[model samples]
Target chain A: MANVIPPRSGTAFTLARGQRLTVIDPCGEQVADLVAFRADDIDEVISSGRTIDYASRIFLTTGDPLYSNRSNVLLEIVEDTVGRHDFLLTPCSADTFRIIYGDKEPHRGCFGNLAHALKPYGIPPDRIPVAFNVFMNVEVDGSSGAIAVRPPLSRAGDRIVFEAKLDLIIGLTACSALQSNNHAFKPIHYEISS
Target chain B: MANVIPPRSGTAFTLARGQRLTVIDPCGEQVADLVAFRADDIDEVISSGRTIDYASRIFLTTGDPLYSNRSNVLLEIVEDTVGRHDFLLTPCSADTFRIIYGDKEPHRGCFGNLAHALKPYGIPPDRIPVAFNVFMNVEVDGSSGAIAVRPPLSRAGDRIVFEAKLDLIIGLTACSALQSNNHAFKPIHYEISS
Candidate 1:
């Protein structure tokens, strides 16, 4: 059975090694922020720096391994429908809305949602590193080192699948930022299988 | 007198609000990894995501402000000689050497150095985020989104200066990674002025 993450919310659960977790954009054009920590030691969390340094490319796709801070492989991309994703931006938070969007009433955003969901497993707030933003379209101007966020290109039913390489604690969220979701909020679906 | 950090090491210190910090590359082709946090609260630390989002560019230099996670300005670059720097890469760690370089005996890199230097301030290892790499040169291919490390463009005596907007606890290093420093590590010099 596939689990559902409501719009602008998140959930945390455990994944055994070798299990496959497939994240689906059921309504399309929505972003999902995913983060993983080793079950035995939360300190060894997924690291965007290590993964990008190894891949030598900002746009990661199938066959790329997500690496941990300790340089161990945590998960590998086995299947992907929409090839674009973002590893640069940290999860959006109240500060993002206040600073970037000038929102008067700021939403707690993905960082807050992930922190709340992962709290049960003893993952503290500060340990929340940059998330793997699935289906996000972040364009980088390599020459000027500039960045711009664009609406995701995912159509209805687009999905990406990852195979866990270690026993992991995972936090997954339906991103709350309006700009990332083509101005609409939608639930995310996920299936865990051996 | 300028405070000196020996090659391949780091130091932590406090800077009062409104004071100025000048980080000097006394030797050519050396990288300095710098991180700062609010003296009152470590949770309000320097954020690469926020800085990049607000600056709209990756290459921060004179006139750009370094923002904290809370959307507050922590430091502003008041002077810069070598314009290029990196905020995308986390400080190199033991895992960096072991995994990327395949070194049998790894040196504790900038990450370890910063952790050690900042430990006394009650800042745990997990609190270390991506740092502002001063004087280091990194190239990004705009079309492919690929990254390449180049030797520091800084020559002897090149300096970047920052003025504190908030009372700050700073962790800074003469980067240990050979590639970042053109295959040689050299001491970093800094002076704090009112």
Candidate 2:
């Protein structure tokens, strides 16, 4: 069955090996934090450093492999309607809000949502790793090494698809960036199919 | 009950808030990869960048607070027999073996051990985060920005203790460095008490 993750919340599910999971930004401008783990073992998870090293690319697109720390291929991107997915950036957390916006009040973010969604399965908040930010616009200036966050370029109905390399448990969070003034945050749609 | 994590293996357990968890280097030369997640949420995990930014020190000692990505205090080092714990380094993974030693063969490492230990709890391999290396001797050269790995200075009963700031699920892995020629690997002892 397909799932519709509400804006600013998260969801978790198991996708069998060879099955494909597609994430859709139904109304565009929303960022989704995508994370995955091997169904058989949670510890040998996707490592951004390793993935960048192996793929020889910082920005992932179709055909790119998401690698685990154990050197295992966990997922392969098969389709991308938005080509600018970021695997290098860590997900926004409460600290991100405090540091960037000087907002000390606890706010909803991808980190918290992922934690809450996985709590039922015994995964705690601290176990959440850095995730792939899909449909989020983050640009780095080469000269200054400065990063700028912008509105996603994807239009409504845009999606990214990945073929699972192993039986996997996936987590998705409608990012907290919804609170930002630059973009409109909207609900995300997902499907896992063989 | 207390646990003895075998060399090159890992185990997971929950430590309630205010509880203390001590990691003992029974044979002195071994290193342990310590990772924690807030027991209630898995996404707001330990971040080396945040911890370093908050502590203002790269090497951890008693009184240093390990900060999560959300800027929350996850653990406070309350006691230490060796003051050189490193929360900055990512755990040695299978890729480490392949890159440094050129060994394409699958080797036992902390990443694998953690994934195996947490499997029953439903954490997948992609969820393991960067870990705090307890008793691992990693020295950084300031002038050249180079790093060197050395045998730990801890003695046969050296240990470090942390008071949980939040209820937590902690994972400890006997590091893969046990296979390195510079040091001998041995079992690590752990205890959780009020």
Candidate 3:
């Protein structure tokens, strides 16, 4: 059964090694932020540095491996329809909406959502690292080193799949930021296959 | 008088709002990693995302404001001799040497050194975010999103200066990674001016 993560919300769960996790963008242009931690030891979490350093590229896709802070492989991309995802940016937080969007009343963004969702597993807010932002469009200017967040290219029903290489605790979010979701928040769907 | 941080070491201290910090590469080609946290609240730390978003560029220099996660300015570059500094890479760790350099007896790199130095201040390992890498040369291939580490462009006696926007707890390191410092290790110098 497909699990539905509602708009501006998130969920957390565990996956055994070799399990296939598929994240679906039920609606076009919505973004999902995903994070993983070693099930046995929470300290050994997913690392954007290790992942990008080994992959030699920022935009990861099929066949790419997700690396942990300890330099261990945790997940591998088995399928990807949308090749563009962001690992450089941190998941949007309450500060994001206030600082960038000038929202007087800030929304507890994806970071907040992920923190709450993963708290039961004893993961604290500071334990969160940069997430692999799925279905998010970020344009980086190479020469100037400038970054821009654009609407995702994913169409409705676009999905990406990952095969876990280690027992892991995963956090997934239907991102709450306005600019990240093209100013419209929507739900996300995901499923696990043994 | 400047405080000398010995090779492959780190230190942590506090700075008042409006104070100035000068980090010096006393030996050319050495890299230093720097991080700042709000004195009033440790939860509000220096954010590469907020800094890059506001600066609109990765190679930050004089006049660029270092932003906190809360979207507030924490530091501003008041002076810079070597303009290129990396806000993207995390502080190198014991795992970094083991994973990238294949060192069996890994030296505790900047990350480990900073962790030890800041332990007394109530910051756990997980709270540490990406440090501003000073005097390190990182070549980013924009189109492919590839990154390469190169020797620092800074010469002996080169320096970068920052003015604090808020009272801060600052972490400073003389990076231990062999690659970031051109296969050599050297000391760092810093001084605070009111």
DockQ (CA atoms), all models: 0.58, 0.08, 0.46
Residue A167 in model 1: lDDT = 100
Q: Candidate 2: where is the Cα deviation over 4 Å?
A: A179-181, B1-67, B70-194
User: Which of the two, 2 or 3, has more TM-score?
Assistant: 3
Residues A60-106, candidate 2: write the lDDT tens digits: 78998888766788999999988876664566677766765678795
Q: What is candidate 3's lDDT per residue for B14-86, written digit by digit as tens?
A: 9999999999999899999999999878888887766776665777898999987666899999999998888
Structure candidate 1, residue pairs in collision: none
Ranking by DockQ: 1, 3, 2
Model 3 TM:
0.90
lDDT of 3 by residue, A16-52 (tens): 9999999999988999999999999998888776687
User: Per-prediction TM-score, chain A only?
Assistant: 0.98, 0.94, 0.98
Candidate that would win on TM-score:
1
lDDT (Cα, tens digit) per residue for candidate 1, span A87-193: 87878898888877899999999999999999999998777887899999988887778888899989989999999999999999999999889899999999999
Total backbone collisions for each predicted model = 0, 17, 0
**Docking band of candidate 1:** medium
Tell me the tens digit of each residue's lDDT in model 2 across B87-159.
5346677776686557779575787888787677666666667688888776544322234567887888899
Cand. 3 Cα-lDDT? 0.88
In model 1, the Cα lDDT at residue A10 comes to 97
Q: Which candidate is the best by DockQ?
A: 1
